[model samples]
Target: MPFELEVCIDNIESLSTAIAAGATRIELCSSLALGGLTPSFGFMQQAAKQSTVPIYAMIRPRQGDFLFSPQEFDLMLADINAAQEAGLSGIVIGALTASGEIDTKNCRNLIKAALGMGVTFHRAFDLCKEPTTALEEIINLGCERILTSGLAPTAEAGSEVLKQLNELAKGRISLMAGAGVNQSNVKGIIQQSGITEVHLSGKGFRNSLMTFNSSNAKMGADEVDDSQIPVTQHQAVANVKAVLDSLS
Candidate 1:
């Protein structure tokens, strides 16, 4: 198979744009501002109804960190069940120990709960203290793929480690390079990291004019309250197309 491009979409508008742009797959989530939390069941159902491409729903309950409390893990389990029922093709999730290692038991339980559905370990792998060790453990636990920035802030900085991971993975699991990937650098990241699959969020933000009334505004108060303005952006098809074109 040729290299695979997975687009991350934050909303329905972006989902449509990505599909139109020729994306073969999508990872659906809410609140990209928070690095993606689980989308609602209704949203997942709507996306599945409208999208021809496979949609993988993010299963994270909150942001901030990858370490999940027992209740949060349970919530994730329920989310996975809901996603399965709503017709998602797969799920993206990750968990880590307080000491910064893969939470194998929780991961294994999640994998089992998925019950033949596709599972991609999310960028939480980058937060692990030992990525190579975590990669090995996830592979052993039967994850289908791992979305990573190679334990670095961006794929470019982590290219060498990602290359090592790609070689070591050896078809056992997929190493998908993401984070700060764009048309300009995707080709280099792929070439250097030796990864065939890549993930990108072709997103652009737009400021909303709508705002809440603030009675507390004073003469000296700042004219614009940053919190009152909502920013909206979605995965664009053109962004995905550009990356594909660069790879080709």
Candidate 2:
């Protein structure tokens, strides 16, 4: 099979871009700025309406680590049920103990919530105590795939570990290369690691369409969040997909 292109999208507009560019799947989230959070129900519903590709909705409730309190964990469960009911292709989720171990019970609870839908363990795997152990555990839990950078800062740098994981997995589960995957290096990562799937945000900057900008107004709590908005460009996505096709 040809390598699959999965694009991370944070809104309805980005979903449009993903479809226009012929993405194989969608990892739908809300706040890409905070490394993606669970999206609003309205936004997700709109995505379901607009997106042609299957969406793997991010099931996080906040911006921090995978560890969640009881209430937060309950909320995540609710999000999972809602995401599956909302017609997303799969649920992307993760939870970990402070010791950097998989929160097996909670993860199982979440998997049950899916009631047999697809699941992808997200980058939280990168923060686990051990990748090989976690891979076995995730496969046991019936997750379809895992998105990781192999505990490194970027997937390219982590390709060797990714290769090791591919060998370890032996087709039990898919290892999706993400975090810094692009057209330039995507073919190399796939060739080196033997991972046939990838994830990325085909986002490009665009100035906010505001005639009169408020100097003091700011959406984020930062020094300067210039209105150079990050929007998904279909051209970038198509180019990356083309590269993957060529290699295949």
Off by over 4 Å in 2: 223-226
How would you encode candidate 1's per-residue C-alpha lDDT over 1-248 as one tens digit per residue?
37788888877867777777767789999877678999999999999999999999999999899889999999999999999999999999899999999999998898789888899999999999987888899999888899998988998888899999988899899999888887678778988988888887777655545465456654333664444422223334455456666666
Question: What TM-score against the true fold does each predicted structure earn?
Answer: 0.88, 0.96
* Lowest lDDT 10-residue stretch of candidate 2: 220-229
TM-score of model number 2? 0.96
Estimate every model's Cα lDDT from 0 to 1.
0.84, 0.89
Off-target runs (Cα >4 Å) in candidate 1 are 207-248
lDDT of prediction 2: 0.89
Model 2 over residues 1-248: C-alpha lDDT tens digits? 68778999887777877878969999989888788899888877888887777888999999989889999988988888788778878899998999999999999999998988889999999999988889999999999999999789999999999999999999999999999988798888988999999999988877888898888777777854667777788888998899988887
Query: Which RMSD values do the candidates have, in order?
Result: 3.8, 1.2
